[model samples]
Target: MVSSFSLFISLILLSLAKGIQGATFTVVNRCQSTIWPGILANAGSQPLDSTGFELPSGETRTFQAPPSWSGRFWGRTGCQFDPSTNQGTCLTGDCGSNQIECNGQNAKPPATLAEFTVAPAGGQDYYDVSLVDGYNLPIVVEPMGGSGGTCSSTGCVTDLNRRCPSELRVGSGAACNSACEAFGTPEYCCSGEFGSPDTCKPSRYSEMFKSACPRAYSYAYDDASSTFTCSGADYMITFCPSSTSQKSANVGPLSISATTGSDNGPTESGDGPLGINTSWLPNFVTGSSSSPIPSSSSWTWPFMIASAYLLFSSF
Candidate 1:
């Protein structure tokens, strides 16, 4: 009985960790206008259904990715394309493919991005909504029909395009630029001495972003609370997700109490979660925005432990 139980427990653990081998990503365009969505698989990962496509308002599409696959998804705005020859230009998030499909091309700057790394067998998939590149629109990645706990929803549900600082704002406020993309400094870009987590620090501009979207990656090193994990779950990637008029809830383990525009507290250029004074920022860098970023609630350790307890109790 003991041997049989041990083998059964091991099998159950593997299933819990791997989530039925792969995952399905459902992309929904909830924006007011039509937007072009782009996809790019990581170097070694298999391709999804389409590299790029037109998602009209209120339309929904889905893609399936194999286990161990990794890639990014983003949206392009103000696009004018010719389906006949598959050519066009976008005001933001263009993959530079000059056509409808990204064809392995990555999204250009000023694009809100959703990234994922589906786990191989016996592993937990990782996902995040990043502002490391910049923000073109609001987005939310909700894990579908899975056990709760750390497997919760995440993403930037705010229209950061409107609140974008003047210097970082793209033409007509179509997208917002990250400080790193705007300045290209080692400090803002988290390169050189600032490359490591210990040396890098968030700039005032990044603080402003953190203030607006508390759960997103405000800067390059914003990792502790920026990444999430899950097993055996599908995802709903919603573009222009409804903007919530509230500050994000406090982080569970990190105890990060962040405030947003809706909250009655500090504004962008003031003290918030970082505990760093945000009185001033360098003169904003003016130019076209460049590409990339990360979210979440808990680590997988607890989930595994919970699974173990449940399995043992059943035994």
Candidate 2:
């Protein structure tokens, strides 16, 4: 009878352990240069391993996220930091935190973003790679292993920076600006008169982004095709996935591995991820604009005690 009680307790503990296991995110840098990936947890959400970290060319790192986690991730380019003061800046996607770690800050405009909200109550994990802020690097979010529902991969596979319109270009052709960022008008920003889906329609500039990457969020109201759903899955985020060879010709084969949490935040190397030593590319289009851009469960300890007593009494 004592052995039976011990076995039951062990089983309960094991079940609890499985229930608390969080989803893992494996971030990969396929660019020829190094990228400092920044993370920002949503308000009231638990934090992850680190707010930011440096990912060298062709290197991959993994971090875990609690169930029901919600956050955004972006790559910083042309960054330089001072360790002593924890102050620094990046040419693109800078969070203006004055430190390597973002410290719960979101990235500035004209940056690519990967957003996620994982459900804990056995619901679908909602994710999307968004160019609504603009585009710097091509990104892909792939599911490692999960069952049920459509766990389809989503990303901006096309190189939008090289093809960005002249008016919406930023920082030595390293990044592209969204219509709303370049021109802060209500039309482009979906504000004032154009606040709702009915009021705001897709502009030519937003259409350009949608045309390039149909699976991504091209504008503020792009939800139908942009958002994706998956359940109980690990994700792989790859930066510069398409142009891996174009920039780093001599880079070695990509290596992937899982890693435990670390304290080292993102830092800059000599060359920036966007400063690819390639020929200058021509511009693409024109635009007019301006401005802008969890569940629970229940259980009772008294019920558990009553159930245990009943089982032991039966024995």
Candidate 3:
């Protein structure tokens, strides 16, 4: 019974993790011994699915989320070619052709190394902007503020006080406020539910982390009842333990008081069989404009124990 219960708990945690992201890890063996054959046999498998690989008692090395064996994980570089057919390869250099063309739908243009520039017209009432970007791909510049930007707007993010710049809007603020409130304030943007954050924000957050920690995997966990937290050092220089930790509740735990017999404090518990159950406040993260990662929250060991108990009871 205990084993089954433990298995159930493990399954719950694993399931929750899968809902967030799917990845693989590859463990390699550097030892020169056959002491453990089957253990480290397929250590270099694709998807890096396993947590750890067996080793023959030597310096074993492994990587999380190793490149997919089937080539399906082509990533940004894979977009240039069909991974399923092309196998595992990158189309980095030129395509050996000049007058290149891109077909509709799944067509990709060849790669190039070029420079580009965009300048305003000189000594005239017109602008003659030049374009260069190695690839020389056509560039599009739109007036975000409905073409009202005049490069003279005051206290406005854009040229005109009409709209916020795309950078401020968070990749075309089709939602949310464009104004990045005083540097440290949460930039509330528009969402499908109006006056809420959007999925695009998280995607942008992922991009920021990738830029900051290119090698390490980045995860943004939000339990609604808990605050937004991260898994790194105070400045990203040192590494924090990858294992999960506790996060304090903005509103502390409930405590029973003898006073009203029905009410204690804001977070106090009461002994009334017929009384309503007051819920704890939902956890939240005050996101910042400059950083993609929200503030970190530290959890307590006691809370973790209680959580484990609650989950076990449910099972």
Best by lDDT: 1
In candidate 2, which residue ranges exceed 4 Å CA deviation?
1-19, 244-315
TM-score of each: 0.73, 0.73, 0.15
Q: Model 2 scores what on Cα lDDT? A: 0.71
Model 3, poorest ten-residue lDDT window? 152-161
Indicate the residue-level lDDT of 212 in model 1.
58
Model 2 misses residue 2 by how many Å?
8.8
- 1 or 3, which is superior by TM-score? 1
Instruction: Report the C-alpha lDDT of model 1 over 43-92, residue by residue, as the tens digit.
Output: 99978989999999988888878888999999999999986897999999
Tens digit of per-residue lDDT, candidate 3, span 87-206: 222232112221111101111221111111111111101111111001111111111111111211000001111122233332232211212221223422222333343332323332
- Better candidate number, 1 or 3, judged by lDDT: 1
Q: Which ten residues in a row have the lowest lDDT in candidate 1?
A: 285-294
lDDT of 2 by residue, 148-173 (tens): 66676777756666667788888667
Scored by lDDT, model 3 comes in at 0.21
TM-score of 3: 0.15
Predictions in order: lDDT: 0.73, 0.71, 0.21
Ranking by lDDT: 1, 2, 3
